[model samples]
Target: MPENLTAEQWRSFVASRRTTRDFLPTPVPQELIDQLLTDAMTAPSWSNTRPYLVAVASGQARDRISTELLNRWDSAAKALAGGLWGKIKIFITRYGLPQSDYKVNRKYPAELKPRSARVGAELYGLLGIARDDHEARRAQWGRNYEFFGAPVSLFIFTHRGLGEYSVSDAGLMMQNLMLSAHAHGLGTCAQGATALWAKPIRDEFNIPKDYNLLCGIALGYPSDDKVNTFKADRLPIEKIKLLPKNA
Candidate 1:
């Protein structure tokens, strides 16, 4: 741990870290990325297995992946909007269907629904997008595949044999990476959407067969756009903590 950081400074750093949706096209330096990865590697893992792998893409590789991902997203979006015929087309072609190792569209549990809804509402509201505007929503969602114009994209994968523990370890490392990126004056957005289709990435990177893509992180300088300023509300600490059985 670095010295001279006061409690307040730590709190501010943690609290100020937000998911940046819009980023400048400026690329992050390779040295800075190396430093962040080094810091993130210090994150604790299950038995130090460190059962995760990361694929970092920039320049041409990043552009190619983004193009492929956008095509996939567009095909899916069109199919979903095309009604019965579109559904039939998707079923017949199997082109737009997600091949994610994990299901990304599962319904939220009843207890967490409100929290999810609130965050979604806040994000769309900031973007001046109405709830009924499906086209606008689809376009905004498509930006995720584009990495919101960020210059660096990181794809994280975990070992299948390790099961859920590998996922847990990956999550820990991801958090560390995001925090480290923020401290370095770089912005990040951890995107689950990027994991929806892995073929494009697999073609670009020589990932081991045992490792499965978990999610992606977009890294770059944040733009001053108003949408980048949106911050979702967090539940209070009291709500997050468990009460003593006797209390």
Candidate 2:
């Protein structure tokens, strides 16, 4: 264990970590990526099952996957705007429907909807995108498939057999990876949108049948774009804490 680490310092470091929406094209050194992965592996696993795998992409492979994902997104968007015939075409071609092992898009719960909406509003507001600007919004959303211009993209997978526990373990691992990257002057964005269509990743990687793609992380140096500076509000500690039963 490292010595002389104060709680205040740790808290400050953790608070500085944020989800980077824009990244520079500068590629992270392989050694640095390896070190971050090593640190992330220290996260405790449930029953030591460690039922998760990661697929890292950079250079040519990353570009190819990004191209494919963007193509799919474009086709899906056109289909959505095509009316009844478009719907029929999507059904016939299986183009618009997601082929993810798990559902990535779902209706938010009533209690959580406001939080989700608020963050989204703030993010788009930072980018000068109006709520009614469908075309602009679609273009922005398409960037997620492009890994937000990050040079490195990671796809996280969880074992289907372990169910929710596997997802929980993956979450812990992802947090560690992000924090480790942040500590090293790197940026990361954990993207659920990348999990919407797994076909592109499946085509590029030899992922096992038992492993389901959970999400993705875009890692690299953060760009100085104004969008990257947007910060969402967090709930207070009291709001998250449960009341004492005796009270």
Candidate 3:
């Protein structure tokens, strides 16, 4: 345990940290951004490899990336409607389809599917969006590409050499970054959808070929919007814990 840090304080802080889906346009200070990055560097890495890279964008750069991503989302959403015409559109407009370095669209395992579905249902419920309202849902999902209106977007990349371990290391670093942001009274949302279209980000930054875009984090002040209040339920410890063989 770190000095001056108590267990209760740590637990409370962790529990208080929520996934902020709505953000204010207020920009986070550059110095504070630097501090958060520095703090995140302290996260544990596999064999001290620290095989992760981050691309930060703010102001005009962030807006440009958001624009490109939202455009792609619009196309992708149309393609999902499913028809010969949708297929032709994707084929003609290649940029509308996924140009991801890694696969982002994946089915959840049977055990985890319900949890994922419940969270989605609850979020939409809070937003007053009906489950079958595909248009509204697509719009809500589109918010991910816009960084939830955050002023800053940090694109995380993991070194392909280390494979899954590098991804794990990146996840740890993101947790550190998000927690640090929360501690500073800033909000952050780790966005998986941001990884769906990496071309927009790659166009803006000179990312290495060996580094695969894994995810993104939106960093800024949270808005007063009701969406920010949604919280996903966690499984109880007993549900997750495995019993001893003898028992």
Candidate 4:
């Protein structure tokens, strides 16, 4: 904390950190990235057990993962377009079907669906993508595999020994990483899409069997693209806060 920094300034800094979808190809220095991870280590873990591992990809390695991921994304998109038969073919072939350690594409709960839908709608609207523009939508979605042009990709994994607690601890660590990146004038987008195909990651990293992929983050300098400016609406405290039993 800076001696001159106020509480309001800190709040504003946090609020300003948005999920950057478009990033410049400029590579982040390895030293700076190491420092950011050091900052992330400050996050408290469950019982001081930081049961998380991160696999970093940059340069040629990043490109290799992106290539494989893009192929899977395209295959999955084709299967999706083919309807029931498409789904069946992919399932039988196991080509486009998610080989993820965790199910990344499960149906959202009824209560949470609207919130998810709202954010999607808002982002597409900002991008001038029409609701009926399936082709455009698929193209936009495919960008996730490309890491939105980021120069670095971080595959986050959690230890299965602690189960959900490990996942929660990883989430906290990721938040710290994102905040640290923002403070250092970098940008990041945490993408569940990256976890849709674990084979690509597994092929690239010597991850232990006890660790499972949770998600990935695209990291680099944010481009001045319009997508970087999109800000989803947040629920107020009243909406999220719990009421007393009597009240």
Candidate 5:
């Protein structure tokens, strides 16, 4: 709770967060993101190994990724859809259910979500995009390639050699970044889309060779009320929680 702020203001600030897909074009100073990354590192880690690294892509670097990734996605879309120009085709059909499914299967590890459409929905919702507006939605997702036009990007990585426990540590670090981003009134989206393109992106950004890309964080100022409106899906508390022995 904030003693400097009323309880309402404190709660409102902490409660605000969204994986923003659209962003204003204005530049965020490097100092702010630097402070954010420093705060993010404060997140708890196993034995304090602190293996997290951030690779930022801004300006030209940001533009390159945006162009390439969108091009790749557009190519896949065309090939799967047989270059359809109009009408709302079912996602699976438009993308060739079998082939798209195979791509998902081959690309993602067991833990990552493989559905590109599902990821798109979460992103568009954060930006208040309407359903069936495929162009708008795709354009919004393209913003990720543009680093949400934030001028800074934070890539989360972990050592390939770490055990699940260390992976969990890295995850905690990601959460810290998300929470702190909310507190700072900055919008962010945790982009797993890059997971499939990790190697390409890693090389593209000149990331150190030892790091494996866990995910990408698209950071920036929201174009609208992204923080408040981007509600999350959650299960009931009872569905996910149970006391071990004190029932």
Candidate 6:
């Protein structure tokens, strides 16, 4: 006989989870969303203050927000794509060739420094998005605005002047929500992309100006037919470790 399926089985099960962008626009029950929020609040926080807060939107509000985001993205992308051959190279390379009135880099915790593309690649593979599909990939990125078609959207944030520990706490809580969503048969995308929309979103959602927009996560039952399915690999433990000097 055989023992129960071991590490491989568990890995395969979790690995099947992926970031789904091709949403069916079906309505998710309010109770289910409620449960997710409940689980999200359980996330660890510094001094147990749980400074983070969430805003959920559905129906017309969701649609309007996505529309505005797409319009802004199109205008910004076109501007970046415009210019003479010489100028275009500047956009392609390093420098001051293509500048935009709207281009923005979302704030990140420099102290909590992390490499985004590495994690993004894992999700891209699971989403079945090709490495070279810049346009397709970017369009997929825009899905964050639509809550990835899940019919509900979540906004996450914290006070602007939080200390380092608080930001870390928020990140931990976010991770808890994402993992809980996964364990509950929901697909989620940890959306740093939406950081660029912070100002617009803060105004749109009526959040106090001093709260820092941390990130967003789009959650829903994944579409079986869509290309997205499976999880990306995490960095090996060895890669993340440094030998202790005392040892």
Candidate 4, residues 1-247, lDDT tens digits: the string is 7889999999999999999999999989999999989999999999999999999999989999999999988889999999999999889888877888888889999999999999999999999999999999999999999999999999999999999999999999999999999999999999999999888988989999999999999999999999988999989899788999999
Which 10 consecutive positions of candidate 2 have the poorest summed lDDT? 1-10
> Candidate 6 — worst ten consecutive residues by lDDT sum?
94-103
Clashing pairs in 2: none
Over the stretch 1-247, how does candidate 6's per-residue lDDT look in tens digits?
A: 1478588876786566666665566776888888877877887777788776676767776667667666666655554556566446545653432122123364556743365566677667767789998777777766666666777667677765665665687778776676667777777776665655654565568776556776667777777754564444567789779999998
User: What lDDT is obtained when candidate 6 is compared to the true structure?
Assistant: 0.66
- The runs of at least 3 residues in candidate 5 whose Cα sits more than 4 Å from the true structure, single-residue gaps closed, are 1-11, 83-144, 225-228, 243-247
Candidate ranking under lDDT, highest first, comes to 4, 1, 3, 2, 6, 5
Candidate 2's residue-wise lDDT over 104-189, tens digit each?
88899999999999998989988999999999999999999889999999999999999999999999999999999999999999
Question: Can you write out model 3's per-residue Cα lDDT over 1-247, one digit (the tens) per residue?
Answer: 9989999999999999999998999989999999999999999999999999999999888999999999988888888896888988798878688878898888999999998989989989999999889999999899998898899999999999999999999989899999999999999998889999888899999999999999999999999998888888978898889999999
lDDT of 1: 0.94
Every model: Cα RMSD to truth: 1.1, 1.1, 1.2, 1.1, 6.5, 6.6
List, residue by residue over 1-247, the lDDT tens digit for candidate 5: 4468898876676666556756777776778777887878888887888875677777777667667666656655455445454223535344322221013235455544544446647756666789977677666545545665665566676665565665688788777877777778787878766554564466566666566777778887777744436566644778668788967
Whole-model lDDT values for every prediction? 0.94, 0.91, 0.92, 0.94, 0.64, 0.66
In candidate 3, position 131 carries an lDDT of 88
Worst-scoring 10-residue span by lDDT in model 3:
92-101
Model 5 clash pairs are none
- Give lDDT: candidate 1, residue 184: 89
Every model's TM-score: 0.97, 0.97, 0.96, 0.97, 0.71, 0.73
